[model samples]
Target: MKYDALQRLLVEHLNSRPVPPHAAARLARVRAAALARHAQRQRQRVRLPEALGRWLTAHNAAARRSAWAMAMVTALSVGYLGWAEWRTPSEADVDIALLTSDLPVEAYLHPNFTRDL
Candidate 1:
């Protein structure tokens, strides 16, 4: 059997069947060695650039600040617009006399009401 298959079989057999003290110690040593090999391989695969990491950190902070400033400006503009609209008078505030002054309905109905030219 392959090393991985052998390791898996050993683990399964050890878990299923009760082993004596020496066999248990031997299995523990094998498991530790396998785990150390896996950890070393993982460490070798990770690569990071020093300059890129610093640049990304600075760029992220600046972006966050800019976003906050933009949001504040937008909120202030909307609030000012709402306040100005609320303070302005509506059509209901016009004087009633302006609407009633130009009527000729009563004069038109009476035949005797005439204008001499």
Candidate 2:
């Protein structure tokens, strides 16, 4: 109840007093100066060396991440291909199979053994 009464009194006191015209002009000048300072601060921020440093830091992080991803993909592809190759039989194994077969030795020596000349 006391707070409400105080608030009502403050409202009545504020409503009774009229602001002078000079105060509005002074407020306008202060607002313009504040806006000008804010603009100047923004301009100075762009001109500072730390702005370039921040840009370079962000750019380098993205580049590093991209390079690392590409390297990992390449490594995994090469590793998978190497593993597949290891699973398959080699040229030496094919030669041994051919040499140990029960077919005639002359048949193995012919270049077109399966086809008629």
Candidate 3:
């Protein structure tokens, strides 16, 4: 294959000429420095998840408190609505008030007359 021939040619060329000792040492030093940098980056990359977990652990109590507060607010709102519905007067109360009132029924029916008055 063409790739096999090219690989053989490259190998032959490299074998024919020896790299200088200084150049080989410099290449090794560069490789070691690159490997060190790569290892440090990998360590830093792996720490992200751990950092996030720590942050969540630190704020877990606050999150739980907020959830409890929301639940309390929801329960209070439902309780207040249930109480209001139960305490509301029916048509019987209206009839009794109309019969017992000194004012005319027409005054109760007037749009301008509020319950506050």
Candidate 4:
């Protein structure tokens, strides 16, 4: 409500007043002064290159740490998979055992069957 009242007041004053030529010049000077003050404050605050360098250094360090962690995890996963593969028995292992051993296949297939003496 206060904003609306202020806006109405501004509109009424603008409508009632004749346009002054010096108003534009005064406004331009005000804008320039505000901008100059803002620029001066910014210059007094921090140097741009130093701020950017600090940010970039932090970002690069974080990136390198993430990459190192990812590489380590990937290496561990690959090593685990390789170890599991090496430890597991395969079909070739079974075939080799069957070929090298003298166990009868029928005894495995028919354990319950018996011959009458």
Query: In candidate 4, which residue ranges exceed 4 Å CA deviation?
Result: 1-58, 106-117
In model 1, which runs have C-alpha deviations exceeding 4 angstroms? 1-59, 95-117
lDDT of 1 by residue, 1-117 (tens): 599999999899879967889988999999999999999987784446855676678788779789899999999999999999899776665335335657556744576655521
lDDT of 3 at 14: 91
Whose lDDT is higher: candidate 1's or candidate 2's? 2
Q: List, in order, the clash count of every candidate structure.
A: 0, 0, 0, 0
Q: What is the C-alpha lDDT of each candidate?
A: 0.78, 0.88, 0.91, 0.85
The candidate with the higher lDDT, 3 or 4, is 3
lDDT of 4 at 72: 100
Predicted candidate 4, C-alpha RMSD:
10.6
Judged by whole-model lDDT over C-alpha atoms, candidate 1 comes out at 0.78
**Candidate 3 on 23-70: residue-level lDDT in tens?**
999999999999999999777755788888878788888797998999
TM-score, model 2 to reference: 0.33
Please report how far candidate 4 places residue 10 from its true position, in Å: 30
Best-performing candidate as measured by lDDT:
3
C-alpha lDDT of residue 9 in model 1: 91
Tens digits of per-residue lDDT for model 2, 21-76 = 99989999999999999999887646568877877787877787898999999999
Error of 3 at 83 (Å): 3.6
TM-scores, each model vs. reference: 0.33, 0.33, 0.40, 0.38
